[model samples]
Target: MEPPSITSHLAPSGEVRDIEKAAHTAAPISDPSVHVPTDTVNDDGLPPLDTSPRGWLAVVGGFACLFVSFGWMTCIGVFQAYYGSHQLSNYSASTVGWIPSTESFLLFLGVPIFGGLFARLGPTVILIIGTILHVGGLLGVASCHTYGQIFATQSVVSAIGTGAIFVAGTTAVGTWFHARRGLALGIVSAGSALGALIGTAVIPVLFDRIGFPWTMRAVALTYFVLLIVAIATTTRRPLPADHPHNPFRISHLAPVSLLGHSPVLILAIACFFYFLGVFIPYNYIVVEAEDAGDGVRSSNNLLVILSATSTVGRVMPGWLGDRYGRFNVTIGFTAFSVVLVLGVWIAAPWRTGRIAFAALYGFGSGTFVSMVPTLIAQVCPDMSKLGLYLGAVYIVIAPSVLIAQPIGGVLVSAGDENSRDRYVWLKVFSALAMTVGVMGFVAARASYQSRVGKGKVV
Candidate 1:
């Protein structure tokens, strides 16, 4: 049988076939869709997965983890708006921007360490500890009276907790699903959208009715209950104690070695630039609307529309990524975000246009946020080093996140608050940053395709 063609749909058999399939499947370094012929070794080298009830349950756990953890990230605009008018009104926009900026900075900085701990301590323990810190941080924030106090509680403590859950929760999903990894991760990403949709609406109501302190306490309580379910359900497949390639081995402590990989380097740069603008809409659209004289109702409604469309963006792209290709879909939508930022968001002069801008931008940027991680995983050469690679990428991207909103604040602060020109500059900056990021992604995809040859699903 003339050595089964590389593209043959035949049942994969023998070591040679496995090697060929893996080679054909490999696009670059991050996305290793290595196909093992036998139903024994999985792509990541774990034993056969139980993609059944127990396994699916773990995915649910991951969904819950992301929902709770990333709620604040997506709904940060609400907090930004609230602080601007209420507790921290005395502070400058640039100073207020630091709260969310610090949260993101710590979240990225801690991902590697949290990833490492997930392997060592497992998801349950790590999640439990994270839940405590997150809930406590919320309670602390409710009672906080000073800038320093809010910074310590909301920015530092709460952020660290959110980071721990984020790294562990997302990683747990991979343990259960291999072939459907993109879809699974995509569903998990939707949790953030759902959380934002619900949390943003709820926070405003609670603030109006119950006040900030009790509202936070109520939110914390809700998180406590959801976390209990997460702790119960999320789990991973353990490597056999005698397995030669121990993932928990000490030598794997640092992600430094991955810094040398060309794909990793390129993607890291792309991520840094891409993230520079991803959070702008999420953090500033409401404030921008308010400044444009849209009033509180219109501004809040825009956020709701953004959150709803983003949910679709997060879910649909994941399914497409699994069927088509992660990089193809991700790169396409990333470029689309530039158009939304510049064309839609920047041009919105009236309330109706602003609403339209929110929905369109939300959809485009939603995919941008949800699909990038899976794209990184698709290009990763070594499955064992996935966490480390993620860590390295975040390290590059974190500082951009730290400074992006604050810079937007500075831009707006530099000119008249009501001047449409000031906000226009912010949009221009966002669109350009995303455009540069798209080029980087295109370059990486093109470079990989050239090496692999055409007509393959990279």
Candidate 2:
């Protein structure tokens, strides 16, 4: 079946709601059993969108959930540097690097399953369980003194919670808004910027003031409170109305088969290469700077600088994406990221140069976590099936994060661990990976335009 034209959902006279609403009249609400629906699709068979109070509330819920999950995930560099000098210092960078890589790997690795679970169980059930596992994992990590203990608690169990809330919160927002989706999702995703900024800035200070174990305890408490708010606020759909089944049957969710679609296939392949090296700066900035004779404090400052710029990166680009086409804005920023990695990160070795690179790279890569879903929505066959399609895309790319971080660690060795490695090869590798990522997106754009045609909804 040919998918409904993007035009089908627009209001009369071809004006999108961002400007003028087409003639749309919502149903009467006199019957408590039959709730009124706004943002209804004209004839696409997709679920109606929600841009009302309930929609924004879902966005808030998404914001809190992501702050703990993807937000904290971005701070892995801070932890990596600290671990190298302190906890797992005895192990080589490659071996100790497995902890964060594994945690990142598991978090994304479980996205497909978690997406399925989100469809079946809804946000509250999934988030409640995620909170328990996540908080419990943090508490466990506090007492861990050995590599195995930390790996088990931080990488495995905690990662599940992190992935769960991320999927639940993200899908909730995805289903909520259409006209303002880029801006709304950007705001929801900015929660990660908040988390990354706070975590990067504060983790080092807290470590000194309270020590590692106590620091973990404090972070865990923060997670508990924020996650509780997410649980209370997020809903699967704007309700009094529920998805035909609040407890949906798993089989009804989009299946892995959707990956075979040409656009999705191309996009997933692109993400694989992009993700493989996209995190190189994030995973290695502190260590790379420190080895080059940048002091620990200076290196930490670089991390903060990167996170701070990411705040602007996430929101501003998204606002532009809403006004311009999402594809144009995303592709433009993505290509700019390739330039930053090669031109700035590779060629510049001075203190001033590295700081500049941090700010630029952070902004350039900021849209990725927010806009990938918006892109996915463009090609999705059905909105209700989005969770599975999103899972498929991310899972295809999960191995990249798993492999790249360890390889980056190995690349830190220039003949010996003690060598003042400049990481030339790693820089080239990251650029190349991101380059392939760009190529993939360009191809996906072509495929989507060919299939869906021009002037389609972004």
Candidate 3:
């Protein structure tokens, strides 16, 4: 009765009774074999899986998607230079400058919205839609004669499509690898650099012979082929039975929680300034070179060098981040960028130094892009929330692009017709922003270290 008066239920033998008492007082036993560790699983019940052959194939496909999507954006600088001289020559440099900047801004801003869509609709549907919109946007741009048409077709529609495809492709890669996530992401992200290199080398040749419309069409065709490969090869890992639906509820989209987090906030600020500065060189370097009378062919060659150098910089930094720590590597690159902007870009009085600056800035900026996402992954718990967080950051970043390119153009436009004062101002802004960005990045890294102790290791 009454559980035999708890103590009375013990075995008669003293040893057994003592053993039972000790067991009762001891901590609850955990079943090591049965309990899955948090470190071993994604927020989904999926176990930490190795990169499979199929996964590698998917990575290759995803790389192609990234290559086309980002490469196309990088090619915008070249387009801006060309269009500023040709179809849009009638428009002021500052006005025409909005086209590529708007496109880049939209590409960055559109990610979170499309990321949510990707989570719901799945990558296949999103990727297919992206392919159509991307190609269609190019075609639309090719047919357009006015600035409004170019903005509508190229800047808004195409950028949105590229953002969606990029989110899907990168997220797919994220889902497949954990241990190798940084390396995998780096490899895929490098596609943009590769695409830039290819575009820089090829687009100019096409522009000289086939013209902008045909060249874009050729680019569109390349995107189509690459997207088909991505769709066929890429896939999401099977989510666990208990995995939460990644619904884009208004609450999930609320920026307060992530924005309030110091690391994320710092990251957002860093990105804003980083974009503000980085895009200047990208948007104006060709123009500056041309202003210096480098010749159109030489301007194109400078872009090719920047693109090729950037390809290596993007990938190597990712691999280095895996070893040296993401934040550390990122800050290092950002600092280097500031120095290049000030020392190489600003001080350059001749063709050789300007070319050197282009190559240096390209490599440095590429490293920054490749490492930021990896750094973000370290701060966030749920991979599904990556889009929301990244999007929020870009919300700030988008405006920076909107302003930066135009301001650079205005600076250039204000200079004595041949003085290159615009470039001088562009370099000044880039250097200042990069310096601030590096500081922001350092703050972010310190926040990460404070929360999760240094030497503890990721």
Candidate 4:
């Protein structure tokens, strides 16, 4: 048999599907047994978008989850610095780097499984379990004494919980809004930037006053409260009223055939390369600044600046992406990130220059991070299958996130561990890696345009 055509899901009329009725009518009842039959296709094979207040509320819930989950992840630089100077001070930078690397690896690694679970068990169960694991893992991290213990607590335990929240929160937003997806995702993603900005500033203060253990406990408690709010507000598919399976079966989810689809293939390749180098700066820039003689306080402030600028970077691209194309905005920003890495970052030798590089690079990188998923959602053959596709995509990139920072650590630790010049090669490596990332995006965009025609908004 011939492979399936993605266009089959699009409306023949080429007009946006009116999902307002379904949004209002489907699953209005409080019964969990109700399953609303969704319009799986519209003019673009996107669900009928309901730009409802409730939908935006789901966005807020997602925002909260990301704030606690990814926000903490983004603040890895703080921990990297802390661990190197204090707890794991005896370990080499490259060895100490593995902790956060493992954390990132697990964060993306479980997406496929989580995606499968989201489709089967729904978001509520996933959110609740994720909240438990996340809170518990953080508490565990607070009390852990050794490198191995910290790895088990923060990396394995905490990472899985973060992944669950990530998959559930992001996919929940997808089920609600289609037209405003880029904007919604952007806003939700900005929560990470907000969280990072706040955490980077507060963490050091907390570390000094109450110390590491209580600081982590305090963060865990805050996460617990926020996750509760997130779980309460987030709902998947708004209770589909007529579905056959009361408890969904994994077999009923989107088939593996989607992996072979052109868009999926190209997009996955793009994401793999993009992620490989994308995280390096976020993970290592503060360390680089610290090594350059800024010391601890200034390095933490640099993280704050980077994340503060990233907040704007995260949201603005979403708005721009909605009007322009997501691919256009993403590609533009990804390319600009190359310049920031090669130019501003590599050339910056002083405090002022480094600060400028932090802000600009953070902003440029934020666009790529915020808009890449929206682009993926656009090319997805079925709106209903987005979680599955994202899961697959993240699975492909998980290794990249796992190794990117460790590789940076190796480069910085090359020859002498204390040499500032050691970081120059890492910068060069990131620039080269990001260059390949841009090429992947360009290739994917070209392939998408060839099939859909250049004029389509996607």
- Candidate structures ordered by TM-score, highest first: 1, 4, 2, 3
Q: Candidate 2 — what's its lDDT?
A: 0.77
Question: What would the per-residue lDDT of candidate 3 be over residues 365-446, giving only the tens digit for each residue?
Answer: 8888777666666665445455555666666677887788888888777666556454676678778887888888888777
Residue 304, model 4: lDDT of 92
Candidate 1 lDDT by residue in tens digits, 404-441: 98998997777665565567777788888888899888
TM-score of 1: 0.88
User: What TM-score does each of the candidates earn?
Assistant: 0.88, 0.87, 0.87, 0.88
Model 4 Cα shift for residue 136 (angstroms): 0.3
Q: What lDDT is obtained when candidate 4 is compared to the true structure?
A: 0.77
The TM-score of predicted model 3 comes to 0.87
- Cα RMSD, model 1: 5.1
Residue 213, candidate 4: how far off, in angstroms? 0.5
Q: Model 1 has how many clashing residue pairs?
A: 10
Candidate 1, superposed: residue stretches over 4 Å from native: 1-50, 240-242, 245-254, 416-420, 450-453
| Model 2: residue 93 alpha-carbon error in angstroms | 0.6
Stretches of candidate 2 exceeding 4 Å from the true structure:
1-50, 238-254, 415-421
Clashing pairs in 3: none
